[model samples]
Target: MGVGEQLVTYVTQNGYYIWEEFYRHFLMAAYGVLFASIVAIPIGILISRYGRLSKWVLSFGSIIQTIPALGFMALLMVTLGLGTTTVITTLFFYSLLPIIQNTYVGMKSVDQTVIEAAHASGMTRFQLLRKVELPLAVSVIMAGIRTALVVGIGIVAIGTFVGAGGLGAIIVRGTNATDGTAIILAGAVPTALMAIIADLIMGMIERRLNPANKASAASQ
Candidate 1:
């Protein structure tokens, strides 16, 4: 059977728990993205504070981001060996660039006049960042995070090659069989759907936190 016909046949005839695999896949992506965000946000804020240092720091992160997923995993395995730890670590690094870059850009984009106003009001640097800057830049920060999260979903698949079991495991099995097109589709379809759904969900969050939207809401 061809890929499409075999996919239908395999799904309808089998009792395999694709649902379980889907959940695991999502769990891995979520954990990795969340962890990266926790670490990246602070680094991004710091980068913005140190303008001269920003280029070098972000460039280094961008270099790490450019590494192919499989190749990155291979390198990690040499030090960490194969497991969920290695996979999550790989995904975490992959998630950093967008999160950090977007965060810095968003924060930097805040108006200098507003910052001066805050300073005149006796706001400390921390207060200015916490109360005014972040709120205004929330949408932009989310934009970066959203990009990272979406990309992480696809990259999580490569983890399977390193024993970081995910939907990728299903695809890998298919590839090994040299005719497991159905299996590959089974994993690929769900992964694509998850990425799309996440984008819509995150985009909604970005809009909600957008300063423009808040003003509109307040006027109503």
Candidate 2:
């Protein structure tokens, strides 16, 4: 059959199963990004407070980012074995740099005068961070998250190699089965859509959180 015909047949016959794979693929990325944010954001906050340490912390993350994704996942497989745990952990590491760097940059960008004002107003260090620094820096932080989310979705497709079932499984199957272009597209198309939709949603959220965007809207 032609590739196009094969794709039509695959989708028509296995629509429900395909949807399940799509959901699994999404969950794999979503879980990684969510947890990465939780872990990295705090580290970013800590480094921001101790500016001397920020360079070293970010350098480590940058080093991790430089490692090839598949190679790192294979390394994890040696100790962790296979399946979703290994995949999630690998993807989690991939998601960290953008969030950590962005969070640090965002909070640091808050005006020193504003910070001093808050200090003079009797805010504790934690209070100043919670109320003043993080709020202003939220846009940059969200931008990092959005970047990670899109990147995570693409990377999670590789999870299938380790028995972490996702849409990538279909692509792998297609590659094994005569390099069927149609079979691969069934998985690839949806994965691309997930990236697009995630970016759009996260972008809207970022713009909403940005103070400048809010003020511009109010002015109009």
Candidate 3:
């Protein structure tokens, strides 16, 4: 059969399997980003407060980013074992750089005038951050999260190597078979689609969170 026809056949026959793997893939990626955000955002905020530490913290995150995904997972596997845990943990480390960097930049980007105004109003440090800085920085923070998630989707494809399953397994199966172009495309097509959908969704959320966009919409 032709590659196109075979692709259709494979997808049709494996609809449930594809759907299950797709769900698993998204969950792993999403969980990794979520976990990273919980830690990274707070650290980012702290570093923004203490400017001296920003360089060191970002440097460490960059170092982590320099590590190859497969190698990183291999190291984690020694403790986490061969499974989704290893994949998720690897993804978490991979996700840290963009998020922390963005958060720091976002917080620092907030207008000093606005911060001064908040302080003049007798707002405490915590209140100023919660009420003023966070709102202004939220869109930029969201942009970082969006980047992390889209990248994580791609990284999760490698999870199959660790026995984490996902569409990568299908791709691997295709590689093992003779003339498995159709099976490979069957896996690849969905992976690409997932990344595209995630980008679009996150882009929308980022736009919505943007203060300038909100102001423009309100004026309209």
Write down the TM-score for model 2.
0.95
lDDT by residue (tens digit), candidate 3, 92-138? 99999899999999999999999999999999999998999999999
Q: How accurate locally, in lDDT, is each candidate?
A: 0.89, 0.92, 0.95
**Candidate 2 weakest ten by summed lDDT:** 173-182
- Give the lDDT of residue 84 in candidate 2: 85
| lDDT computed for candidate 2 | 0.92
lDDT of 2 by residue, 1-220 (tens): 7878889999999899889999999998999999999999999999988999999989988998999887888999999998988888998999999999999999889999999999999999999988989889999999999999999999989988888989999888878886578888999999999999999999999999998997899999
Better of 2 and 3 by lDDT: 3
lDDT of 1 at 148: 86
- The TM-score between candidate 3 and the true structure equals 0.99
lDDT of 1 by residue, 114-198 (tens): 9999999999988999999999888999998899889989988888888888888888887888688788888788889999999
Report the lDDT of model 2 for residue 77: 94
- Candidate 1, 112: how far from true, in Å? 1.2
Residue ranges of candidate 2 with Cα displaced over 4 Å: 218-220
Top TM-score prediction, candidate number: 3
lDDT (Cα) of model 1: 0.89
